[model samples]
Each structure stands twice: as structure tokens, then as C-alpha cells.
Target: MNSNQTEQGIRTLGVDIGGSGVKAIVLDEQGLTITERSRVKTPQPATPEAVLNAIASLASEQGEFERVAVGFPGVVQYGITKTAVNLDPQWENFNLGDALSKLLAKPVKVANDADIQGLGAIKGQGVELVLTLGTGFGSALFIDGKLVPNLEMGHHPFRKGETYEEQLGRAALNKIGVQKWNNRLQRAIANLEHLFNYNTLYLGGGEAKNINFQLPESVVVIPNISGLLGGIKLWQN
Candidate 1:
């Protein structure tokens, strides 16, 4: 956490729901929030029951708040989840928004995990595209200040026997060398370029924070807070 971050407001609770764990943050209105909010490992089978239980647990630690925002590793339609690539395949039919709001007893909004990060990076930036190369490749698109969630373009076809994740994810980087990883990443970005034609790109995920190679001139390495910050925005929705 950055030093200046602690000096802000605390009316919001933001949670980033990932395949690994659920991270919670209690922030003031001015954005001052505790860094070590709360966290717990996510259930491997990520059934709706288990994921909601984890969220309730984290909220218990932060007490009450005006709203709650959760980042799901899948597609969401008015709060219903449609996927979680790394967790339970059952998440494909989750009513995450209603489930979480019931659990928290407050307004709740769930969005794609990658969009959470993208939100933090380009929340106020009218139009942008974000790609997160974490345990897997996650992506989100924004246009005219609105979020278009669950764009599973990561699963779109790429090089031989390779989906976008196979070529651009961290696991793939570990399997191949950085040089090859960059090659695949460049290709993957090319896909986004052709499909979305986005002028700006925000890159995140645990791995992208350390990208050393020269990326596209329009690409920006966003801080991880985009996920958390995006959660805050979702909470207000």
C-alpha cells in the first residue's frame, strides 16, 4: 500500500474476488483505506455458496458500510455470474449480485474480475481496454463511460493449440521464456487491437506489474488498485 493512501476517507468496502483469495478494503470517501483490509483463500470449487460465504466473512471483519462491490472471475449480467475460468465451472449460473447483496444486507454489484482492475486504472477515463495476465488472461472493455463486462476474448483463438490465455497468461510465460512470452503477448494485443480498436490499454495482474519489454505506445501499466477501486465504483452502482 502507498503511504498517501492511508490518509483518505473510509465509507466504502471494496473486495476483489480472485481465484486465489478474496481481498477486502475499507476506504474513506477520499480514498484513504487500510492496505491490509482482510483476505482469505477462495474455494477451489468456487460454488456460489462457498464464494458468498467467503465474502460474508470478509465483510464481517470490516463491519458495516454503505455498499459492497465484489469482483467475480466470470461474466456478470445484472449480477448473475456466467463463468469462472480458474474456479468452479458451476459459477456459470450464479446469481452473484443477489447472493452477495443478501449476504451483506446492502447494495451489491458484481463485475468481471479484470474489469475491477481496469476500473481502478481507467475508471474515469471515458474509453479504454484492459487486459490482465494473471493466473489466466482476463479482459474488460469500456466505451463512452460504460463497462461492457465478460468479454471472454481470452479464450479466442490465437497461435497453434493456443488460446489467448495460452499465449498471454503468466502460466504460459513461466512455461516459455520471456522472449517467447512477449511474442505471444504482442500477438494477443494485436487481437484486441483488431477486435476492440481501443485507443488506450491498461495492463495489470501480478505478472504485468513487472513487464520490462517495450509495450505498445498506447498501453499503460496500471497499478493493482484498479480492481479495488473499481469495486468501490461498483458498490455505488
Candidate 2:
């Protein structure tokens, strides 16, 4: 592809990097998948270099693509990862976008995983919130389709001086039985509803299926694929 094609972003490789796995898919200009989604186990320790290698391996599996977009499970500011609570500590302050671009020989953009998932799931209407249940809790807020960016609500105190992630993350769920976890999630929903007053709440991530309680009418459970699908929006003007 030429510069114009690259600029237009004819084909985009979308990569979602999480604590447990890294998934990639090729999408056309319309943000529809054009290639089969591929996934690999996230390397143990998940250091920046190890994760980059995993992503690059997936990138090569997909056919020609003009550029790449990545959703990372942490705060990403201008492609620099500011946090990695679930991954190795070495990820902090790393320039993931530049690293991936150099590694893959393609332009790259990166954003917080939940933020990208919100980009894919939001309705672009009123205040919206997205909560991803996985190895850790991830959150994003949007108002009228404009992202608030890096809200990190998961790290905020929720109950008993514990952060939301500490109480709702996969580790927490496993520690507490399913019944207790479900109760906690219910309380969280009520609290979040009062706090954000969002018109919609989207629940996503691989663990979303574990939610056993009846969700409120305004809350919707989105497929895990939204994490990868939302990558296309990172390149949008």
C-alpha cells in the first residue's frame, strides 16, 4: 500500500492485549473483520518485550495491513503505557506504540483497553460507562460519544476501603464464591449507577459471561470481541 492508502487506512490490524491473552484481527476500512481472529496466551510475566513479541507474531499471521491499532490493559498516553497492574512492572513508562511500529514496520496507535472497548460499544448518546471484567476491572467513561479517557475507576475505592478492581477482579471472584461475587457485583452496579448517572452501562471482557444476576435495563453485556473491534477507532480523526 502507498502513503495515500496508509493515510486512508485501508486495512487495520487490531490487537487487544490483556493479562491472560493477546488477540488480533484484521479489519477493513469499515471496521468489519476481514480475517479470522487469532489469539495467543499472554506470556508469563508479560513484560513489554515479551508482549510485543506475541503481538508481532499475531500481526504477521494476518495479511497485508496499512497500520495497526492496539488496546492495552492499562493507561496509555500518546502510546506510552503508564500502568500495568496485572502485567510486569517493566511496562510502566514504555512507549508501546512506537515499539510496535518499529517492530512491525507499520504505523501504530494505542489506547487503554476499556477505552477502546467503549469506542466499540457506546451508542454515542448520553453519558455512558463501560466496565470490563477480567483479570482486572477496567473502566471507561464517555459523554455524548466524546471519551473522557483514562478514568481508571477500577482503581477507585469502592467498598471497605478496597478498590473496585480489588473486589471485582477475577482474583477476587475466585477468592469469594460465585454467590458472594454476584452480590458484590450487584452492589457495584447500584453504586455506579448513582455515581455516574449514565444512560447506559456496558459490561464486557471474557469474564462478563460469569455475571449471573439480572442486569438493569440500561446495562448491556457486550461480547469480548469489542476489545479488538474498537481498535479501529484509534486511527479515526
Candidate 3:
């Protein structure tokens, strides 16, 4: 047991369901990490059932917790998944919160993966935008700490009739090489700055580590860990 476990005696499990993997961590009431985050590769076909099973296995490693907060890679409204993105089309309209809660035997809170990430990364003031670069691009917009969920900015048309993800996602980076990919990111940043005029922009996700250029003062790149680290905040709302 750590200081948080001894002091507060309360903890919650934070789960991040990604396109490539699922990660979970135990966080005390004070928002301190209590366990080394556990991870499992997202199963083949990446259906709701498969991902839920994987998350359950990850949660089991943490023993027990009061509640579960999940950040899923799609549009989530009141625990229902509205979009699938990189996941199976079957995930659409799935009541993930109810299903996961039933499986884990605990209350569950579900939100857009990027929205959950922004909850951790934002300053809770002014206009903020978070972009997650991974198998696909995930985006969340916020103003004064309030989330504007399900923007799905990645699918919108961008350069040469390609969606932002087509030019900037992991597959794009692997296909175009880091230098060109980084250039694309720079341009994307410029475009977003013009479009949203956000006070701050946070870049996260597995591929954020690949950024090689200096970002503008308004831009910040957060660790990939923010994905799971931000999970606790889901219950705060």
C-alpha cells in the first residue's frame, strides 16, 4: 500500500481503450497513480465484446476499486457509443457503460477518449484543443474546462481531399517517413490554430512522441501516459 492508499483509502480504476491497445491504472482519490498501468493489445476485429473482455482482464490485475472510468476511441454519450472510428462498425450504438459495469461489477463512466484525455491535460480555462495521433487522429475541444464532445475532426477532409487521419495518422507516418509526417503535423497545427484560435493545444497519444519540430508557444505535447492518467477525472464530472 502507498501513501494515497493509506491516507484516503479510496481508489478508482482508469481504463483507456485505444485503437491498438487497452490500458488501465489504479488511482487514489488524490489522483495519484497506485499501480503500474497494465496493458493488453486490442483484440483482432476490435469489437465491443472483445475490447470489453480485454479491459476486464486489465482491471482484474488491480484487485479492486470503487468505480471505473473509461476513455474510449469514439463518440460516447451517456455510456452509449455513437461512433466506431478505428474499431468495428458493430460498436456503433453499443451501451458500453452498462455492459462494462455489468462485467466489472462496478459503476462505470464512459466518454470520448480524447475528451477524457483533455480532462487531464487542459488548464480548465480558455479554449483548449487536444489532438491524439495514433492509428487514427482523435480530437477534443474544450472551453473553460467544459468539453465539446464528439468532434471527430480527424475524418474531415484535409489536404488533397484526404481526411486529416489519412495524412497524419500512424499509417501515414510509417508510409511517408517522419520528416514529411512531421511537416504535415506542423501544417495541421497551423490550420487548427486558424480554425479554432484556441488558447492552448495539447498533443498526445502513442504517436505524439514522433513529433520532431518545435511547436508554437500555444502548443504542448503531453506524454502518452496522459491517456490513462486522465481516467480518474472522468468521475469528477
**What do the candidate models score in CA lDDT, each in turn?**
0.76, 0.92, 0.89
Model 1 per-residue lDDT tens digits across residues 129-194: 988877778888888657786787788888898798777776778789778887777767777788
**Candidate 2's error at 3, in angstroms?**
23
Off by over 4 Å in 3: 4-7
- Misplaced by over 4 Å in model 2 are 1-9
Compose the digit string of candidate 3's lDDT tens values, residues 1-237.
Answer: 655443466678999899898999988876678878899999989988899889888888987688988999988899999997788999999999999999998999998899888888899889999999998999999999988979999999989999999999888999999999999999999999999999999999999998889899999998887887787887766
Write down the TM-score of every candidate.
0.85, 0.95, 0.96
Clashing pairs in 3: none
Best by lDDT: 2
Error of 1 at 112 (Å): 1.2
Model 2, 144-190: lDDT tens per residue?
99999899889999999999999999999889978888899999999
Q: What is residue 173's positional error in candidate 2, in angstroms? A: 1.1
True lDDT of residue 14, candidate 2: 97
Candidate 3 lDDT at 161 equals 92
Cα shift from native, residue 112, model 3 (Å):
0.6
